[model samples]
Target: MSIDSIADAIEADAGEPIPGLREGLEEMRAGRSGRRYTPEQLLVRSARSTLGLSQQAFADLIRTPVATLRDWEQGRFTPPGAALRLMEIAVRHPEVVRDAAA
Candidate 1:
């Protein structure tokens, strides 16, 4: 489609507004971001990144099996419930986790 035609279509749709966006904004205005994430939503690599550790080092520090840690990082498998909980804890308190692991 031509640029002008696309612009016209977008302008027309703009009047309708996106559903729920206003409600979300109001929730945020009321101090609730409405953001929620389960531990399973966290990636293994991200947890390690927050701690500033390499894969092998992170696995060793956490005492997680290297292969299992790799599997999680590679998406070959998601961390199990217990592992996910640990990852959440690690992300939230990297120093404590690191010290305790040590």
Candidate 2:
């Protein structure tokens, strides 16, 4: 279809209800479906949040590059075993990690 025709059609359907969109939204609101993080992602994000540090600060504290930390948090890549262990310790004993970093 022509661009103008496509635009007109889009405008025409602006008020039309998308099939199952409402149901999907309701399911997400009720905690039935949404972006679910992997355990590793949760660990990395939780460790940073628990320590109240920004990504850069957390990366510095962990002695990893910020990009690598972002990759771990975004699930683009899994952290190495050592990093995982450190984050696990951070989660359980944030004070210890903080003191050690100091």
Candidate 3:
């Protein structure tokens, strides 16, 4: 007859108990969490750090110039169209990058 009754009827038809609805509601509650960085960004950082390379050295590894790497890191310049795509690919496929380099 009412909304609550209608919900109960639907739950009954579905053969599901609604008693744990509170748990579902609690699960829906928002929680604090940090935002994640993009794969390309993380890869750039990791590649540089892992190789113990400066921006210039990292740039060389990625087949770009030092200034470009610096710009990418500092947000002063984007990696350029194709360059950005390459960075994304490298990020997603680190082993590929390494194998290619070797």
| Candidate lDDT values, in order | 0.74, 0.86, 0.65
- Report the C-alpha lDDT of model 3 over 13-102, residue by residue, as the tens digit: 889977855444444454533354555556566656655667876687877878778766655555566776666666677667677878
Highest-scoring model, lDDT: 2
Q: In model 3, what lDDT does residue 35 have?
A: 52
State the displacement of the C-alpha of residue 34, model 2, in Å, after optimal TM-score superposition.
3.2
Which has the higher lDDT value, candidate number 2 or candidate number 3?
A: 2
What's the TM-score of each model vs. the native? 0.56, 0.68, 0.48
lDDT per residue as tens, model 1, 1-102:
554454456657797545565555567667886655444545576789999989899889878788988877766677877888888788888888878976
**Alpha carbon lDDT of residue 83, candidate 2?**
92
TM-score of 1: 0.56
Question: What's the CA RMSD for each of the models?
Answer: 10.4, 9.2, 11.6
Which candidate number has the best TM-score? Answer: 2
Residue lDDT tens for model 2, 26-99 = 67667796777999999999999999999999999988999999999999999999999999999999999989
Ordering by lDDT:
2, 1, 3
Report the poorest 10 consecutive residues by lDDT, candidate 1: 34-43
